[model samples]
Target: MNSEQLIKSLLKQEEGDQLEFKLVVQKDSIGKIICAFLNHEGGQVLIGVSDDKKIVGISDAEKWEKELTDYLNSAIIPEAPVMVSLEQVGNKQVILVKVWAGSKQPYIFDGNIYFRRRQSTVKATSQEISNLIHNRQKNEFHWERQPALGVELEDLDLQEIQKTVDRSINESKLDENNRNPIDFLTHFGLFQNGHFTNAAVVLFAKNPALFIPQARVRVAFLEKGKTAGEFVDDKLLDGNLFKNILSAQDFFEKHLHTTRKFSEKEWERQDDYVVPMSALREGVMNALVHRDYSLPSASMSVIIYSDKIEVFNSGKSPLKAAELKKSHLSLPVNPDIAHMAFLRGYIEKIGRGTIKIMDACKTAGLKPPKWTTTETSVKLSFPLNIKLGGATDGGLVGAGDDNINIRIDGAIDGAIDGATTRTIRQLTILLAAIIKDEGKRIPDYKNITDLGSVRTLERYIEQLKDIGFIEFKGSAAQTGGYFITDKLKKIIK
Candidate 1:
């Protein structure tokens, strides 16, 4: 409901198990009420309201909002989900602190368990604490442990299973005795009671989509200003988890451009992709390892735009968005899947993937990647531009006598006046290569430019040729190649 409607409805209710009213911001009293609400059914605490239910607004709503939010974030134990906002009730403003029923219950406050007893908040009795703990444990179910109804060992890829065993053994993540595929699966809890679990199928099945269609990753490459339906290229990848990861990386390599920077201090060259490849790998791996496969229609996706790359997964993160930036506990939604990935060295057991992504970006002089969460999914975005180093004047510069320093800015159009740094570099490299060798073939251009595909190289060559910078100098039957035109040679010193 809208804030106005919600506040109007809440105003008519008396303070009880699901609602509380306070005349001012009493930090201790509000903490107890929020803790009790988390332990029981979720509730709301409204500040600036009298004990008689009058809307006596606070003196400064903005200041109270931040003060209460900071208090809740710090005072609460285990970091429960609490939302604090300012809402208007009639002509006055009130602070509303909304708390959700904690999935990990027994939320503690000041070394005690608080309980909501009808209309009052008090310390929980011993029996109530025991019941909360017992209920939490009883309701915890791991979906990955469930049996795949018709899946068999033969349906899994034996070679991939063997590879995992070898890699895990080499990495000391698995014992030598578990080298066999069946033993490896059993050790990792993928095989129970002589039946294959869903994780086994997800990790090693030849065609996981046949059994669980949601076990797929969709990738798309879109040019700047393009809609979702208008894609430069896209693919739906389905197979074992390892295969999908590798395939997605290959797709990224195909579409993403690499930038080369020459370091004058080291007298060496360094090459980096537009977006850090390691960060993208971590993003994809995290999406797969933590995905909620129980939602049959939900799947992961990687959308590549000209300016940013977005990696989206099916489930909301266990921690809040703010918590992800700081140190938090590792709470994997699919433990079995995460465990297998860990053993294979694809991911670590500790919660450091987000940190790794941010670090990679910072080291590469790019803006830090952003993580956004919603009710049903989480998305990680890597902006392609916004560099922190190199040219600060928003124009290209020369690093050395023979090296040109190209830095990507916010512009993405491919025109001469507004071309992306990568595009300009490609065109310049192609022309320089032609100048060095008078008759350069397409293969030679591909080798020198290191563009992902022959089609991309040809596009660059065509752009140069159309601008009267180069020309073809041979017939169809004879040996032919592109040669620099006099128009281009006149500019060369």
Candidate 2:
């Protein structure tokens, strides 16, 4: 992929030593430069360029070429070394060294991991290096692959595993007769070489730490967006994914309440589809679907606040989040986890979770959640239903079950663009009024609608028409209007 353009493109962003250019005249210094970039924000070290980027091309690029190759071979295995390439730029052949912000934090070289300080490579202070290395072993902490030493597979809770599989299959709508626990595990790619992968065991193993430590999910219900706030609630989820997922669901349901009905309107219990429920549910689904099972200190997290819920899991997304939102890509960091979620009906087929999320929010009259995946974590924000003890609409307020519709409406009010909000709201009202023969057509808005004047209703109809959310027809009927393209229909179709 456009390696030259990639380097030039990154220059558009604010840069520091995170992306520094180095003139590697001495082949011996290549290893240290590799360590510096790997241990930091991951920069490009252009070999032939001067500090000012002048094209003082290397006389013999092959010296650094051999050194670069040897450096990778000598670096720690698994994570290996930064990716390096030689390219010609403006008559000068520059060796482009691309290092990822290494997932394995502090990279040790020559018995010492060197950190870059304002373009200077310095050995890490003892305390700093200890902390850095301590945090580096996230993805390397594969518990299932290691033996529990004396522990056997019998150490697992078979009965619980059976229950989990049954529940997952039921939730997923799979044929019960065809899916056994082992079979389901195999289908999810959790089973490998006669044994379950670490991820599989995290989701199903009785005591995952028996062989693999750090296989638990972390859930925190916070206030004020910080951990020190009133510990709204906290939990360390264990057992298999099935049990853990369902348990997480139950935990929030207990703390987060919704109204039995939104309005005194008889259609209240009729599934107006409040977004918080969907948000809470999807947040867990995303965590389970994307979390990196190999990461130790980096674990799955679900943070619930008074105003919003933020869900995070380990691993940088392979797809830019903008692409994920636009395309139907399922680049799962943990395919086994994603497959398990798919089978359990936690994730939709065709990798259409984002689409469903958008659809659900539109249907619920709530805003779709925003997606942002970074190098360290994947985050989703579900807007809070109630703010400051009152809905954003300024009607009702309170926590738990008393305020559901308010939150639902608030999300829509806050998230969508102005044009979209107006168009969708009009469609919702019009569709709600339409049933059997009780409603008017798209162009008949002025008469049948209850939101005020004929002229105002006509303006709304016209706006909807121009926006492609509505179309009109017929026999010179001035007041005729209809929801030709409601957001929900548009989303699904």
Candidate 3:
């Protein structure tokens, strides 16, 4: 915010949350720095401040001001202008322009989102892209109406919209009055100027391909048919939620091997390795809901190779990929989409899609699906382990809700990934520590016991002792079992 600090930041030669500096020999490089701040972490770009931090003031400040203003407004998408200020440090002048991160992110200059990392202005890595999205999400960015051009509301499939409304009225409390799709969008805060947002278009447009040319959900048979075995089938998926899911399920079942279950009657058949309908429903629903429509890319894709099924979409995540790996992860890209899926019975409100997928695969005896995400995409892989065979006979149970074993099992699975979102749950041991001093065993939160919270508290106490995160000074009892450790303070920090 200040030239003195900006000069210091430039000298440090370190890149992080904010701050980048450049010695621009010409105006083109100025564009790069401006784009860098807009695309990644918001920062102040200081020119005339040498890369090594020596300030050399511009001889013509007015010329540089005109140069910067022209580039930021005319050359950026979701067009955001940079705020430029000039300062004199010792014998030199510095041109400082503040580029705030965009609300609709992935800010492009000449067609790509340029970002700052340490000493360079380059393409942002997937993680950096994802973080930009996380920050922008808090400032009211919606998936639709971004990069808006080439389409209108009526261009969308009205039938699809009507059916969605019908489903909402039939199953949810959306309205006795607001039963129209247009009204539904208004009710959902997705309408501007009486037209649908890009989210609406991508999720339910009759032919989203007309506007978003790359918009699709492809199902490929990779590792087969003699190529890299990759299928780039440029086909479109359309219709109501049920039909769309059914079609996607059909595509998945095509790749599966089914078996005959001989019962008392004639017979029943099942896929040898079907991706659980529940999981796929949740996954695909998430694909539809959480996708980053701001980017000019595909809406969603499901690629089934020989070893696994990879489901991908433009998912703007709330956490870094490393943080996601370290904690139990759940960040809905679109809560309204989630709510819609929940009422329609495709997904539950509990937000444990990973748990549901794992359970369905387990009861059917398949290895749990693996998850990997970058800023632009989230990919979930369900292994083909034919030896595990297709899960048959276990009816779909609530993996995300109405289940405790599911949440506990999720904690364990996530433990394999290093305990992502459940960090606070682990910190609940502090809840126990605070009570242990009062000489009372604070029993449990009987109301929300479905979290297996009581069991987790006891296990956390045991774990704290085991790893030295806590200690027991006296003999163990129902009460007065311990005091926290040095590690506890580290965790507190």
Each candidate structure's TM-score, on Cα atoms with residue i matched to residue i, is 0.54, 0.47, 0.45
Q: Candidate 2's residue-wise lDDT over 216-319, tens digit each?
A: 77787664445346666787876566777777877776656443333333433333323446656776777776666656667777777655667778778776
Candidate 3 per-residue lDDT, tens place, 107-169, comes to 777767778776578877878778777866754555544433555666766666676678656
Candidate 3, residue 300: Cα displacement in angstroms equals: 3.3
lDDT of each: 0.72, 0.55, 0.54
What lDDT, from 0 to 1, does candidate 3 have? 0.54
Model 1 local distance difference test score: 0.72
Candidate 2 TM-score, true structure as reference: 0.47
Worst lDDT run of 10 residues, candidate 1, spans: 386-395
The local distance difference test score of model 2 is 0.55
Model 3 TM-score, 2 decimals: 0.45
Judging by lDDT, tell me the better candidate of 1 and 3.
Answer: 1
